[model samples]
Target: MRTRAAFGRVGYMAGALALSLGLLGGCSAPSVSTQTGGPAVAPAQDRDALEAQIAEVTQALRALGPGVDPDEAARAARIAVLKPLDWAREWQVVDAPLVHNVKVVNGFREKGVCQDWADAMEIALHAEGFRTLDIHRAIANARNIKLEHATVIVTADGQPWDSGLILDPWRIGQGRLYTARVGEDDRYSWESREAVRAWTREWKARALAQQG
Candidate 1:
């Protein structure tokens, strides 16, 4: 009964300037770039792989057609993303132990591919049985992009969400769901970019990569 938000997807190369000390002032991220400066066009084979997977789940929705389940779509989107994301790795490439450091975790063609893919996955989720909404937490606001998370709300309008049971894939293994609050007293279930950067600095102090 807990309607929640989830985030997924990927894109090609994107570069943004790093600001110091977690301040908001930083060079803007370079426009989306792929090996050829174009979107990383999915190959026929990869598209086919997702096509059927998406189709299978889409076909499963009792109330939907052969291709519409938001939750399933979200699941499919995650599957597509898994081909590129390293859910197994903790730090998806940090830059010299600094927050706002440049670390390219997953982007095949590199156009904020993660965002694009995540969007698509949300569509998939809609095709399934769950109603989904998108949320974007700026990296500048959080520090690390992954740590600077974007999540999906698996509930539709008029559905009440449990402010205490939010789930974030990035911070996996934390059993209880993160509660979301709308006011000043909310403990950040979704951390801010500044917080992520600060955390990065702490990470470097404890366990930073020996080389760049």
Candidate 2:
């Protein structure tokens, strides 16, 4: 089966950079203007917290033993996503799109958010060569959608929806990643195929608005 990484390679980076630069739809979210010539103070606490978490994950990987070959990189990336997910909540403004074109900024956020999580995970998992999992951008509803979420859906035998193991790091607060079955979990409302297709239409419309 064709992997999502195959398709996302070119578009992903460009889209992410555009979103980060506040160039999406020519709309800029309110940000702290840096007009001072003084050097910006570093965020020491946040940096320390992130480093500690990475070290913790690295130590866990080491516990797998020297002889045992583990997918250390993938495990590390999964854990690292938590830091950005948590940071996005505080760093990002939860603003509804001024126009459909500008929603990409809200979805992508300044630092990282739900779509960013999914996009990053999708890129990471693909790079890790996970043959059984596919990344899906799952939305909650079809009409008047708000804050659409995303996750990596794990399949048991490389078949879509065969088993629903959702890896969603943005569903809850704190530094924990939320992973669960699609329908069984209350953190997200899983959309059906029809609903997903409809949501895609809306998503594309938003994207087009940015392009125009």
Which candidate tops TM-score?
2
Clashes of each: 44, 0
Q: What lDDT would candidate 1 get against the real structure?
A: 0.33
Error of 2 at 64 (Å): 22
- Please give, for residues 79-162, the per-residue lDDT of candidate 2 as tens digits: 444544444455442332222223344454253445565666566556655433344445554344244555665443334452
Candidate 2, which ten residues in sequence have the lowest lDDT sum?
Answer: 33-42
Instruction: List where candidate 1 sits over 4 angstroms from the true fold.
Output: 1-21, 24-121, 131-149, 156-158, 162-212
- Which residue segments of model 2 deviate by more than 4 Å? 1-109, 192-195, 198-212
Candidate number achieving the greatest lDDT relative to the actual structure: 2
Positional deviation of residue 174's Cα in model 2 after best superposition, in angstroms: 5.7
lDDT digits (tens) for residues 112-135 of candidate 1: 212333354345445544344322
How far residue 36's Cα lies from its native spot in candidate 1, in Å, is 24
